[model samples]
Target: MNQEQLEGKWNQVKGQFKQKYGNLTDDDVTYSEGRFDEMLGKVQEKVGKGKEELKEEISNW
Candidate 1:
């Protein structure tokens, strides 16, 4: 998926998490987002793939 689609999906997941675990804060979500981006960057660097490709691969999992 593209950037917008990825972001939309993330938001949906975040919403679900917030609903399921009511104590989760925006800061918690933001920290998770940063971790995901960092992991994606590391994967991209190691595999020499673009961000979109990495996202697609991860989505398949």
Candidate 2:
């Protein structure tokens, strides 16, 4: 999904993120408003995966 769609669904997505990177704190999962790249980057770093992999993981969540 695009940044806007991702941002809008962040609440739901956060849960998925937690499931993958259980060590990420709420602050770690949440980006400053509009920081989609930063959020994704953090998730990427934690999961050691790229966007497509992350999307697939989230989709299955």
Candidate 3:
């Protein structure tokens, strides 16, 4: 998937998490987003892949 599609999927997942766990707040969602970014950064550093390439790999998984 492309960047927009990847982001749309992430938002859907985030929404589902919020709905399933009412206790989760916006801050928690923000933290999750940050963690995902960090993970992508680390993977890119190790694998030498572009951001879009990594995102597409994740989407395929």
Candidate 4:
């Protein structure tokens, strides 16, 4: 998914992430304005998943 699609579905995707990754904090899942890649990187670090994989997962959700 691209930036706009991801951002548009962020809340729903965030809930999916939380369900799959309980260890993630709100900070880890929060969507920062114009810094989606950065926030995603943080979640990647915590969950040991790459950005592309995460994006794909979110899209599937």
Candidate 5:
């Protein structure tokens, strides 16, 4: 999926993010209002993964 599609599906993918980052509250993820790149970066930092890997996983989600 492209960035637009990714942003559009942010809410659905957020549950996966929450599962990956247990420390982040629902409000923290939802409050940004679909700023997914930032959220993805944060999740990348937390999980120690590369951007490509994250993107692949996000596409699957």
Candidate 6:
């Protein structure tokens, strides 16, 4: 998936998370998003794969 697809998926997941865990706020989800991006960056650095390649690998999984 590309960036648009990733954002769409994130939005869907975020909505489901809020529905299931009513205490979660936008800040909470946004923080998670930031952490995910940070981790992805670290993985890219160590693995030497482009972000899109890693993203596609993850999506395939």
Cα TM-score per model: 0.89, 0.38, 0.92, 0.43, 0.43, 0.93
- The candidate, 2 or 6, that scores higher on lDDT is 6
Best by lDDT: 6
Select the stronger candidate by lDDT from 2 and 5.
5
Overall lDDT per candidate, in order of appearance: 0.92, 0.71, 0.91, 0.78, 0.78, 0.93
The candidate that wins on TM-score is 6
Candidate 4 Cα errors over 4 Å, as ranges: 1-33
Across 1-58, the per-residue lDDT of candidate 6 in tens digits comes to 8889988988999999999999999999999999988999999999999888998898
- State, as a TM-score between 0 and 1, how close model 4 is to the true structure: 0.43
List the RMSD of every prediction in angstroms: 1.0, 8.3, 0.8, 8.3, 7.7, 0.7
Instruction: Report clash pairs, candidate 1.
Output: none
What does candidate 2's lDDT look like per residue over 1-61, in tens digits?
A: 6546655676777877789989878877655433866777899989789976676566567
Candidate order, TM-score descending? 6, 3, 1, 4, 5, 2
Error of 3 at 23 (Å): 0.6
Where's the lowest-lDDT run of ten residues in candidate 4? 27-36
Put down candidate 3 lDDT per residue, 6-61, tens digits, no spaces.
88998999899999999999999999899989999999999999888988888888
Better model by TM-score: candidate 2 vs candidate 3:
3
Model 5: which residue pairs collide? none
Task: Candidate 2: give its CA RMSD in angstroms.
Answer: 8.3
lDDT of 4: 0.78
lDDT of 4 by residue, 1-61 (tens): 7767776787777778889989887877653433877887899999999888899886887
Angstrom error of the Cα, residue 47, model 3: value is: 0.6
- Per-residue CA lDDT of model 5 for 1-61, tens digit only, reads 7666766676677877889988989789767655767888899999999876898786895
